[model samples]
Target: MEELTAKKDFTDIYTQESPYEYLKETRRLQYRIPDSTKPLYLSLAEQLYNKLHKPVNVLDLGSSYGINSALMKYNLTMSQLDDFFLKEKELTKEQARQFFQKK
Candidate 1:
């Protein structure tokens, strides 16, 4: 019972907002996609892509800073990944939209 209470107290700090809201700020701290999982994720993506026979617009809820987005895209499309690299290379640090637009 004491342990439960302690857990609740810890949870309350972030529960003022929904967990998803807190996640927007803290997900990177607690959640990480291990490198070993990449191959599994890629295999799953390949299976789904082959089954559907088309590109899928995947909405990754609670994604931390788009790391999952990057991973999923890497699995799904090589051409797109190449294009993204090309675009990123052309952008200066100040022109990098990911950091600038978030704020």
Candidate 2:
């Protein structure tokens, strides 16, 4: 536990004003986004919905920038997200909002 707690602090990276930087840093380190587990999550959500006969809500802990939520809700892959961020790196706030509205 001590060794775990002693790992290099990444608060600065996690607290960035833009998620672009965080994604870039993680991509640089070749960190996998666990997007492959989307099918499992979807399956579980479907089961819950069927059992409850209603829409189910999810709580994604530590959901920095809501990558998981975006992936699940928008049916997006990590590669697509990376490409989108790279291509739209210079988008203004309103432009970004419009983009999502179209999605």
Candidate 3:
């Protein structure tokens, strides 16, 4: 069997001053695990909601920029998030607030 090894230590990336910059670097590196797993997380949340018959609180460990919370709460796909962050890169605080308020 072929062995897999990590090529880089991403500890430095985690220490970026801006979360957006970290996300941009991760995106550039094609780190799309969260995007791929979003469906599974959403399904699990749905199952929990169905079983509990109430709001389900999710704790996202190592949440970083709260991507999981934003994805679930806004019902957004990773592509949408990428577009928002990458394309609309200069949004002011109020604009971002209003944008998410619409979501």
Candidate 4:
């Protein structure tokens, strides 16, 4: 009723537009740099990995594009990911062919 209507605007994520809208739309990707916090997250993941042993798995709730999983599984760096998905490089036929060929 009136109480519910008077509640704060907690559901509106669009109140402040996203800064990485272009990256999200064009590349179908979302970016969130963990920066100094990466080590902490990695350390926690390592602990969990050790507890579970080989074939460690992680469930990143808000992970954009699951970059943390990639980092944990493949040891890929953020710089490498950035280089791999440069905005200037359009998807080519050969690239598309090779992508599907690997599997």
Candidate 5:
């Protein structure tokens, strides 16, 4: 009972928008996709591709940053995402808008 209550109390923040609403001003709540789970997600994507026999359109519900969408659509690894979105190249607002528009 005590462990269940503790878990519930810890997860109370998910019941509201305050956690994600602060992203603009504070990156304190960044999503560091666990390396261990990356392979699992990638394997699942491959399985889906094999099962579908065509392009797979996946909707990662409640994904605020679209990380999973990019993974499912592009079959990318977390390192690739870190490189594309955070490293490798930096773009301004206009460049980012144009980049997405081209896609």
Candidate 6:
């Protein structure tokens, strides 16, 4: 526990008093995703899409408000994305489990 609480560097998760707090929070609220993961996700998505030569499906964990899903759809040329999302929003708990599980 003591080791976990010790401060290491600016990027360390345990560094609560870092000056990057506002910048981090701003990004989290804007995209509903962490700014730190921007490069990783973008690079992977592009690479995977290119490899498959088709649209890539991503399973966004902790998908609060489904904002990431919306953003992903925006990157694709699909018809009626809102209709698809509306159907997903109406899913029951069991249905939701199946939906995410298939991802």
Q: Which candidate leads in TM-score?
A: 2
Poorest 10 consecutive residues by lDDT, candidate 4:
13-22
> Over 4 Å off in model 5, which ranges?
1-30, 34-36, 71-93, 99-103
lDDT of 6 by residue, 15-81 (tens): 4432133233333334223334545677899999899999887887753334355445444211232
Q: Please list all clashing residue pairs in model 2, or write none if there are none.
A: none
Candidate 6: lDDT of 30?
Answer: 42
Candidate 5, 17-55: lDDT as tens digits: 332322221223343453445567668868998998887
TM-scores, in order shown?
0.39, 0.78, 0.74, 0.47, 0.43, 0.34
- Top candidate when judged by lDDT against the true structure: 3
**Which lDDT tens digits does candidate 2 get at residues 9-101?**
558868766567667655665655548777888899999999999999978778667777778888877777777665655656676566566
Regions more than 4 Å wrong, model 3: 1-17, 88-91
Angstrom error of the Cα, residue 56, model 4: value is 2.8
Runs in model 4 with CA error above 4 Å?
1-32, 52-54, 87-89, 92-103
lDDT of candidate 1 over 1-103, digit per residue (tens): 1223332223443444222333332332433443346577668777898999997566666543344565555442323333343344344545444532443
What lDDT would each prediction earn against the true structure?
A: 0.45, 0.71, 0.74, 0.50, 0.49, 0.46
- Residue 57, model 1: lDDT of 69
How well does candidate 4 score on lDDT at residue 67? 53
The CA-based lDDT of model 1 is what? Answer: 0.45
What lDDT score goes with residue 76 in model 5? Answer: 57
Better of 1 and 3 by TM-score: 3
Model 1: ten consecutive residues of lowest lDDT: 1-10
Clashing pairs for predicted structure model 4, backbone only: none
lDDT of 6 at 101: 51
Better of 5 and 6 by TM-score: 5
Residue-level lDDT tens digits of model 4 in 29-101:
3334544457777888788878888755568766555556555555655545454445344655575345334
